[model samples]
Target: MSLDDKNTLAVEGGSPVRNTLLPYGHQCIDEDDIKAVVDVLRSDWLTTGPKVAEFEKRFAEMVGAKYAVAVNSGTAALHAAAFAAGIGPGDEVIATPMTFAASANCVLYCGGRPVFGDVEADTLLLDPSSVESKVSPKTKAIIAVDYAGQPCDYDALKKLSDEHGLILIADACHALGATYKNRKVGTLADMTVFSFHPVKHITTGEGGMVVTDNPDFAVRLCAFRNHGITADHRQREAEGSWFYEMAELGYNYRLPDINCALGLSQLKKLDKFVARRRQIAALYDSAFADMPALFSLAQRDDRKSSYHLYVVRLNLSKLNASRQQVFGALRAENIGVNVHYIPVYWHPYYNKLGYGKGLCPVAEKAYEEIVTLPLFPAMSDRDTGDVIKAVKKVLRVYAE
Candidate 1:
């Protein structure tokens, strides 16, 4: 069909993308997932049980990390990692503002200040140079997030951390199945964190993990998750003693056995799930290749993304419609579109903490045009086609 003919028809819009609705993301749970949870329910142990250890061990092996500590949520994992890294009062941790608030909040939880850094304009990943510019004498750590499942430029980040004698924490919450320079996300930094929320690559209802090669950090993480208690109940009973000691101030961040069982089951299928997500991303990339009004986040050559979110940045200057209008039009066509983030520092709480609009110019500008489309393992080919059609229609109708 002629380009003008296609554009005209789409603007008139006789048919919507799909007859029904599709959420931005959804978990793919099967019979095995249900059986795993049921098996845990039938067992004697629920929280702080053998299943937790099993999940940790298996996950560590999968990611080529020496140790792994399971936690109740991604925020808990980040908090434990930050605390273990010695982030406290008077310390500053550099982090990208393009991620969820939890990434920065973890530093606050440790009584440390979070220094927001601008992101790369094309990749939307943390800009290493920007992070270095934010570093100061009080800087103690760099929490680099694997935004949109793409690993950040770790080599550059590590160099900055080493130069400043700072800890490097990989917020791999969106990048469990991702790889950087052929290494898994879990082993990329000093302490790597993963999330098992329903929208992530794997789901334990709501759980997370911290993986590291340092045994000391693993021990600290364990204690931090259990209210700084030295020994668990099972360990005390096995030693023929009812003695446990509180070593430090910690939070109740332990993941339950039921959730671990589900996590373990989900881990078995992570490779497949990531592959499907990548396929969906490829389809989107191909469909949008020639579209001038939209561009997807750039993937780096040194890493393989897990495709946690297929976000497209609209070229608002080339379009007659604003981002909000296009987003609303897509939703009106049953295309479940959403924005990935509104810069972490833009939140009211952060603003109250003295962080204002100009914290990160790149991130602020990106936030204005970014739109997250429906991309999940459970989405079928037909479903993907619907999303593609819907996006094209919206852009066509709004094209300058």
Candidate 2:
């Protein structure tokens, strides 16, 4: 199935990229990962145990952070960070719309307002200038997401936060292994969050962690994750006391020991996984160098991306087909392409809350042309080739 052999698109009548479907992202798990889980299953404590603390300790050390708080999910990590930062009624948090809803939803969960910031046109990251412009007196924090695994301009963001007396939180769900200015993603912001979903760089089944240098923030995060309780059962037993107090309102956001065991195993392969993703990204860059109708996201010289996604912006003006048509064509050919997101405010829930379109013009425009390609550490060369072929085929068919 060479391109020259086909005169039409797969949507019409031509050879498809592959006979099988390739999803956007997939986890890479090995025997070690399985054995770790099994070992935990045989332990007495499954949810809150020594394994959880061990995972946190290793993860914190891995990222050069003083502390790491493990939680049930990435969303919980965000919620805990925001809550610990004292985000409450009448406070505003600035966040980019070019991310998952949880980035901003965490603000709303804290009874605070989320002010949308536009992203840079080239990198598709939260622009510091845009964030500066959105800051008001009520602004309490900035939740900057490391979109598609590329770290944001932390120096500029830190300056802005300092100038405004605002908390800086990194929603680094996509950037566990990413780096900016020679520093790891976890140590860049006041508090950095990581997701361990199956699609992420590592897997804990369903888990997340928040790492930070501030001892106060770490203590607050721990209490917040455990129903605002001041002590764990282990602490109670050691002190010969059964009494525990709920100091503040909190949720059951604890990450189970079984999941942490899996995470610890996966952490051992983090560097390897990230290297493979970076290799795949480089291959895509080289493959698309000559393609005129597609422009990949700009890679900054100072930042090293984990490449959770390899997104390209389509030059729709040069193509005969609309984005929807191209997306459908790719899907029709078993190429599991997807849009990263609709601007957060574009969702009906946000709309009902008076967040309308045109809030962040750049994000809205980028959303229309962006296409997320398949990129994962587990992808075989054949899988990568299929993605490249499918994209080229779709572009050729839609070329004006």
Candidate 3:
């Protein structure tokens, strides 16, 4: 529960009074994940091999999905899902702006136009009412981001999507272990995507998975991940490799066996990781509960968060200083506080498409007050204390 200030800041151990440096988010790795990769390295296949299939099967079963397709990255999985879902030119895919650009960019990848839907004032997740306002004749899909590992109001969003005859793509990158109304997130959307980057709940170096119950979509996604060429032919070829025809144009987005092995290993510890994360979050929750001057996102009814990134909304009106100053002061204190996102439309790329201002005002306002706090399963109690202490210290100095 301690961090060494004089040495590398990887683990906890510091002076009696020296504050521990807390990171916003990071992955948890154990001997098991490493051993899994080592075992794979010594096996027969390396890339696009047996381990990949094994990982997909286990992961699909974990999330209660009929099938899962592993890809090189979350963005790739999104792109494949969009492509196979028939997102083409002039098609509109509604989403919230409070997420990373990848959520909307995936729509653009398949020549679909990304439409921004405002968020709920509290959760900062896609608002079903706002989403309804953006649906048009060309609307083909709705990609709802599970921001902060909390599932968006899927039941409402589902009704809207169903009414419009649009697909629902849950960018569940932040909600792998999250649940909505007692059901897992992966099974709630038409296509649920997950990320295994170093900063996520798990680590596969760089990997993502697309889960769906539709067999046809699974077949198309599998083909799309491997250059649209059927791997069934490769398995049958013995003497000489027979040429395979492209059922449709696709990309090489399949994840390597090494990454899949790492993911599979990490998946084994998924429950443990989530439990630890919740424990840490509970400590923070208790610490910040009495501080009403701050605005923390409240847990909702019938939902379980994965605690991917525990964000606290700064009550800018109560503080004597601006958000930038407070954020800067925290970083100077080595607290490593970060911002979750800057509304997707605020990015210049989206601006070029004439997605100008005055859209999703709620999300834009949340962006101004949002600050991501350190939350990782590997975080020690001392690390959590340091983050809490740093935050309180900065707020005390900045508060009127």
Candidate 4:
């Protein structure tokens, strides 16, 4: 579809731009996903039932983890992991600034400080070198983010964590299906969290899960997500008992069985979805190769990235339009392009906490150039071509 074709969908010609909006990512739900949800709705239990445990088992097997606990959201999963790792008020957890807010926010929810670690210039995953440099006595964990669905250098990070006696966390929200050195992502860290929000590789209609190999940590996570009760609420209710002991303080972060059913069904199709996404990514990667005004994020041949976002770095000096301008211009052509993130510190909330700008120079630098192109399993080849053409048309004219 060309700009001229997209223009037909426009409500007004005020900007002579098309109105066909393309979002950066979306869920590729199928009839099976619908059927799964419908079945759950018809089941006896709606929340935190057998289906939740099923989903957890399925996901755990998929990721090669020993245990999994479902949560209401990715933030909840992170918070649970942090608490299980024993992060607290005065502790600091190191993480990259390029990730979604939940990665860092999880630490805050547990009353811990999120110390910003710089990202690698190419992959945008947390740079182990920078993380090592930033480590202090207060640092209790390293919340490594798998930016753009690429796995972070977990082997190197593991070594550092072992030496420092720090908990290594995998904020694997973006890289659920990704691999590192041929090992599954979830098994790479002390605790790995997955997100099933609408835009992720799979969705539970807004849910998350935490997976860990440590039996003790898994127990803590399971307990923390359910009001710190040792027994399942459903089990107690079935036993005609109202009495349940609260072993510790916890939150109502339990993921509903209804939602978990959706996750299970969605997981079945995950490989196919990832394959399609990779197909599109290959096309775009080839298209952007040797381009003057744009560069693709670097990847490791040995690693399998889930490709949650197909991000490109803008060569601003060669372009006439700014990053914002390019974004507007793409949307004008009915192509949905978006910025993946701003540095976490740049947000007003972080600013109030004395997290000043320039804290991680590489992250701030990447923020200026990074743009997430529209990529989803359901997108047709035509949609892919449209995005490619729209990008070249809008960006080429501005290129030096």
Candidate 5:
């Protein structure tokens, strides 16, 4: 396993480390999950039923939030949260460019402007000082993303939000089980959002939630997910009244009961899933600790990440090839290494909207070197070994 082993790289017409490609992430479903969905299918109510409330209650309690509203997807949850925050035309929200476009697109959905903020050089999380510099009278809120399941520096972000009278939104879509300064992510912001996408810590096929301590935000979130209605169908039926009102414009972002049932079943196994992810991350951390050409992201001691993604940054200065070449080498080795993100503003649509390069220098540079490795609860020790061996092999070949 030494660098002097003289093994030819798979991309250089040699045998691959594995015959099959190992995906970066995947869902782990079991019999219980299938049974939950089957039970929901057999029940009288399907879409808007008791399972939704049950799932919401369990999720809110798990994260120590006072309330939770279920939505169809993570993007929908963000949009509902932004809507509840009262974002409108001419309003601006400070957000990090080091995340999925949805993090910033949610603000646009509310007819608000998304101001890009730079990230910390080591952690890739939003820089509080940069956020402060972006703040203005038109800035209505700060959408602090919990990048790669690690909570942002919320204490500092909260201080900035308070000073500017801005609403603080935690885009904890990657951080459902994470903690910051001993507080769960869902309780750390004015409103917190979580996703149950297949690749996330837990899955309900495709669902999301917004948790908050503020009852006003909770009510608004509930209404926004149901087409801005005063009451849902169940509420109307319970009251024996057919009357309802659409007080404000909203989207049909409700999560179906079947999905909630599956989510509840998956929730029961979330801690175990997260624990396995952490175990894999630890293995990666140890494997790359002494390797000068590659390193894991900086993690603060005071926080715990759910490890939704295990990303490593390549030291291009020590490598003879570009990030693309190394990425291709890994892929050739049948290791499905992928990039976490390209800066949100660098996209063509955002560019068309006047967002140009150099908006967030650190994020832009980090994007060139960061690659996501295979990680999931279902991955075995042998699979992990294969990934490590492949990475070391590829990096060694390109190492200076």
Candidate 6:
């Protein structure tokens, strides 16, 4: 079982490093999480109830935000935030292309255009200078994605937003417990969005939240998630009235009480979950620090990442294989390595919109080499070791 043996490369008909595939990400559910959901199921309220409010309150407190609005999914959260910011026809929002399509698509949902901004070569974060260059008279806001769970340079971005009189939104779905300059992510931007997908730091089955200090944005968010209604059914019942009005068009994006209950329970273990993710990331960093075939994404000294994805950039010049070849080899080795994203504008849909290639050179280049590794709280040390060994073995076999 010598890792140095090229004949052991799984892609070459040799045995894999591990018998079972190691997923890039997974959820860690405990008995306590089950009990919380069961309690909600046993209760009378299932949809919108006290649990939703409780979850909102606790989550806001956790992130140091003055208000929180829970929604059905991260996409809904982004749409709600865009609506709250008053994005409309002819407006433009600057966002990095190195993120999930939803980050940019949300702007299109509100009848606004999403202008692609380049990322830094090392960190893959939205480059402030690129954002500044993209700003125009049509620019209404900036959606800064906390790619790979690390916070962007908020100070630089905040100054740019203030100078332009534009709103700053944080797509922090990957950064639940991350911090920037000792401040939690939710408090950094004008509005911060978090996702509770199973693979995220916490799970609510399928839920998301938007935290903001602005009461106006909070009100808009609440209304937007519930068909733009001024008051919910509970409020009407409490007032002994049956009448309600939809002031504006909105979506049915309400997150169920059942999901909120699970989120509340998961929230209790968020710090622990984040700590384990960071530990796993540290282990990977140590193992890959000297590996010439690849290098991990850069981390800033002032910000701490929750490490939702331990992504690495392959040094293709140092190896004889392409990223696709390496990716396939890792898969053959039972290592579920994946790419975080394709440049958003490169998608067929966006391409039809006349967004040509080479829009964001740095992001487009990074996409060609990046690979996401296994990173989750439930992974044991041995699981991490298997990933490291498999990656090293595969890359070593292809190294020039």
Candidate with maximal lDDT? 6
Candidate 6 lDDT tens digits, 324-372: 9999999998999989999999999998999999999999999999999
The candidate, 1 or 4, that scores higher on TM-score is: 1
Task: Give the per-residue lDDT digits (tens) of candidate 2, residues 285-307.
Answer: 99998899999999999999999
Q: Model 1 segments beyond 4 Å from truth?
A: 1-15
Off by over 4 Å in 6: 1-6
Error in Å for residue 24 of model 1: 1.1
Model 3, residue 68: distance off in Å is 0.2
Cα lDDT of candidate 6 equals: 0.95
RMSD of 6: 1.5
Number of the candidate with higher lDDT, 1 or 3: 1
Model 4 alpha-carbon drift over 4 Å, by segment = 1-19, 237-242
Each prediction's RMSD over C-alphas, in Å, is: 2.5, 1.6, 4.4, 2.8, 1.9, 1.5
Q: Tens-digit lDDT track for model 1 on 1-400?
A: 5534544333245555667889999999999999999998999988889999999999999999999999999999999999999999999999999999999999999899999989999999999999989999999999999999999999999999999899999999999899999988887799999999999999999999999999899899999999999999989989999989999999999999999999999999999999999999999999999999999899888899999999999999889988888887888788898898989999999989998998889999999999999989999999999899888877887888
Tens-place lDDT digits, model 4, residues 78-172: 88999999998999999889988878988898899999989889888899999999899999999998888999988899999999999999999
TM-score of every candidate: 0.97, 0.98, 0.93, 0.95, 0.98, 0.98
lDDT agreement with native, every candidate: 0.92, 0.93, 0.86, 0.88, 0.94, 0.95
| Inter-residue clash pairs, candidate 6 | none
Instruction: Give lDDT: candidate 6, residue 193.
Output: 97
- Pairs with steric clashes in candidate 3: 2-12, 2-13, 3-12, 3-13, 3-14, 4-13
List residue ranges in candidate 5 displaced over 4 A: 1-6
* Ordering by TM-score: 6, 5, 2, 1, 4, 3
- Which stretches in model 2 have alpha-carbon errors above 4 Å? 1-7
- Report the number of backbone clashes for model 5: 0
Provide the lDDT at 206 for model 5.
Answer: 95
Model 3, which residues run further than 4 Å from truth? 1-20, 232-234, 238-241
Error of 3 at 289 (Å): 1.3
Angstrom error of the Cα, residue 102, model 6: value is 0.4
